[model samples]
Target chain A: MTAAFLRVAILPLVAGFASLALAADIPTAERRSGSEFMGPETRAMQDDDTTNPGMLWVLDGEAAWRRREGAADKSCADCHGYAQTSMNGVAARYPAFDAAKGRPVDLEERINMCRSEQQKATPLPFESQALLALTAYVGRQSRGQAIAVADDARTYPFIAAGREIFERRQGQLDLSCASCHDDNWGKKLAGAPVPQAHPTGYPTYRLEWQTLGSLQRRLRNCMIGMRAEPYAYGTAENVDLELYLMWRARGLAIETPAVRP
Target chain B: MVVLACSAAAAAPGEPALRSFAIVGDAIPDSLTGAPGDAARGRAIVFNRQVGLCLLCHSGPFPDEKFQGNLAPDLSGAGARSSIGQLRLRLVDASRLNPATIMPSYYRTEGLTRVAPAFVGKPILTAAQIEDVVAFLATLQE
Candidate 1:
């Protein structure tokens, strides 16, 4: 009996080892966005700029971009000059590998980096209205463009780490992100449908939250729901996870300021 | 939701004391409360969102509730599937059955990481509540 049990256990160990050579679980052809699962009202809200509440942040961000700030007295427009032409499709390719930081830096962190280094300004706090507004505005420029994370060796390790985090069970519930998003997407958990968790629409507005929130905020919320210790904002884990999601979401159109219920 | 103590003065109000119970194979043959639970109360608890949260991951034979979950096994015919003792053990801690289960241990409070400050040292459900849930589940023989 012990020999049979050992054989059964060792077979799974071998299979687990084999699976480390990770392939995308959801095929490129089959990947679906979170928007597909939403109600018609919410989808209509995302489709129109005027109806979407997240557009408010986008508008505020547009104003902040043109306004001069910091000791250097430079606005974002001073360096980038016209978001429609220069900033278009930029948000699709983040969190990118940062050579200076020796790690991945998300769009928010990149914005902060530019602020501190170029504008000589204080960094914005995570989830602050100003930061959300700025991220929404920038991300809005990438709307309709496919999410395209850099796929070179520089980002490979971080992406793997993110995948590990997604698969590893944690918290009192012993649930991983994959337990719901991968294993059981399209199923209902209570009344609500479980989304595919594509990082397509962000800084997306959630009706439950009644405000625009970043992808990191959403990630933290899931971790808390799992009863796990959410990493502090701006931590490497969050950025790495963002990178992995962006990579997983490659080919999906950006939908910044997308409305969700 | 009310917890009764033999010596009321020694226990904090509304605080549930965990009773020692033996696990016999895959079941807990003994009741945690030393008395049969009220099935009506158990059914009420199952339907209550704040208390049981069972509907979050289970669907059952209630025609009224619009949104039952599809995450776990349906509560319909659960009594026919599991023995009462088996149901009790599962409510206590399912990780012993399946380590990767998303179901929370409704009656366990230890070894959990990063529990919210307000819920520290408290099981998701009381001992009597577990029995109540078990009794309720045992009635779904169809």
Candidate 2:
């Protein structure tokens, strides 16, 4: 059994070890904005900001931006001031390394950190409506701005872990994420086109889900789809995965509050 | 419509349950009761993504079927390469051959998690369905 497990675990690495870092690495043309894979009707829905269901959350986010909360009596606007100006492009460069904490944090985790530290407020629960609204609102600020997350030596380990997770086979399905997103993207599944899964329009609305969702929520859904155990919210594994997604999607424009089927 | 989950059509308690087949070099225990291979039924199951859902990872020569995936080997010539016993073993449980294979066990149910209640202990495909799939795959010599 151990021998079988070792063969399953190590064989793929041994097989792909030589050129694994070369031709098939990131910055390939496989990158596609999520919008490219959707049906035209859905694409049309996303194109019109007023018609997109995601915009409703963006409106809620606009309200949350000004509404005061927390023990510190601070709203997001109190510190950042006008998402159009202050928060612009911030979403594009997130999953940044937190120097003081000595870890990686995606935008959602960063938002939670601010709530705890700066606002003296308890962190909003994961997948909460309020959190989704605020994230969507903040994410919308970077529309059309290219993703530019970091991937230097300091972040190399996290990036590597993220890549490893992408390639690792997990769950009862024994499927790796790359099996779908990398190998068979653009193909149809059940009738829906499987996009390259570029993380360009996260905190976006999904047709399967009538409400807006964070990237973590979507990742959780994928884990469940594959029957794999998912990382807890705010865990290093989740953040590293997010960082890898951001790096994989580097230079793609942000499309927060975007709608998808 | 492509029903992603194979949890539908539950067998009542005491039906032919999912039998465990130990890997014996590309051969699985075949013949359940009086069931035998049926190509027509297998072809329908293969094309119907909801039941066999083999098209999710495999592409083959089925007209009018779109979105044939490319994650695994194409099944267009699968019959030519593999014998019926080999095909049966793979369909029963590919994991027994390669533990990390992305292929789901269509007829095994021991180590799985999050399976819908309707599917617990019930294999994704029945013994007859497995035979049907094997028969259909065997016809794909070209």
Candidate 3:
């Protein structure tokens, strides 16, 4: 039996080596060549800009954070003081598994949770400009910190579910998330080079939209391309997808409201 | 109907040929449009790698692949959800459908200033390619 198992493993190893050899032989378009086609000036423009448009939302969020609202007469300042010092790196560990809720919660969800549980306020509507600004402000706290999602047993199922959703084929296009993002990244489609679907920076500013938007909104846009029915704004599918994205970008820095072409 | 007749009478047979065409301002059914597209041709546009490469921003039926764009929608069976006219608008120039769209016009005839000189007269996709793509989309019922 052991000998048979060894044989099976050996066969796969040989096949894997053959596949690697074939891959190496294939000619790949050089990175510089692709960049040149896009134009050196355009590329330089992208690198020159450091201030993310999302910063605009963050500024607004700062104001909202300080202003006293709700029936309880409390403000975000009441609990968290001087965000730069008190909330630094807080965004990096969000979308965390909340034991009380028995589910994963993103920064937006946490903000709303705090409003109701501690501030005695009504939760902000998802996708509302106010909520986006709040999220941007909170996310700014973890600008340089590496994302660190929990990988404990309790959270494993959620992560796995998220992964499944990412891989599942959907819509009229019969496409799975893995098809383009995982498979064809770095290649040009239409006129744009496909970037890895990393969530390091979110609530990003898009030149196409000329506005700041949340990661969920971005995902919704992708679904429309797939021609699949999108989940409601706060549905479990979206949350699960967020969980997967956060985990995928576990070590990348959070650049919320980043600029993209 | 009168406006259509007048426009058709006024249009020189070849003038419509050079003008950038896109289906706009009407909710025409797919059945009334031209015949369905050819999947083989549509696949070329979808997976050209250097051109159409729809896979860039979307995930689709093609599973034995890697790397796609993350910003756009997927296109597994787009035909079932949208009409041919809507598809035409998206293909001719998605900016018309959603001014925010990053997708470029495959049949642009005007506004060449925004594009490179080499691509000014050249469309991203030929009319035949668009027809084939639409035909293929019509087949994706499920």
TM-scores, one per candidate: 0.87, 0.78, 0.58
The sequence of per-residue lDDT tens digits that candidate 3 reaches over residues A1-261 is: 222223234433532212321221113332112223344554454344344456778889999999887778888998888988877888887778899999988888888998898778899998788888998898888876888877667776777677667766555344556556655566666546766577766776767788877778888888766545666687777888888777766667776545666
Q: Which stretches of candidate 1 lie over 4 Å from their true place?
A: A1-24, B1-18, B110-113
lDDT scores of the candidates, listed in order: 0.83, 0.76, 0.64
The CAPRI category of model 1 is acceptable
The candidate maximizing DockQ is 1
Docking class of 2: incorrect
RMSD values, in order shown: 5.8, 7.1, 16.0
Q: Each model's DockQ? A: 0.39, 0.22, 0.06
| DockQ-derived CAPRI band for the predicted complex in model 3 | incorrect
Best by lDDT: 1
iRMS, all models:
5.0, 5.3, 16.3
- Compose the digit string of candidate 1's lDDT tens values, residues A1-261: 222223234433433322433343666777889999989989998898889999999999999999998999999999999998888999999999889989999999999998999999999999999999999999999999999988777888788788767776656565778878877789998878998899998998999899999899999999887767787899998998898888888899999988888
lDDT of 1 by residue, B1-142 (tens): 2222221122234765566677777788888889888889999899987788789889999889978899899889999999998899899888767665678887776656666555655677788899889999999998
Worst 10 residues of 3 chain A by lDDT: A17-26
Error of 2 at A138 (Å): 1.0
lDDT (0-100) at residue A20 of candidate 2? 29
**lDDT, model 1, position B46:** 92
**Higher DockQ: candidate 1 or 2?**
1
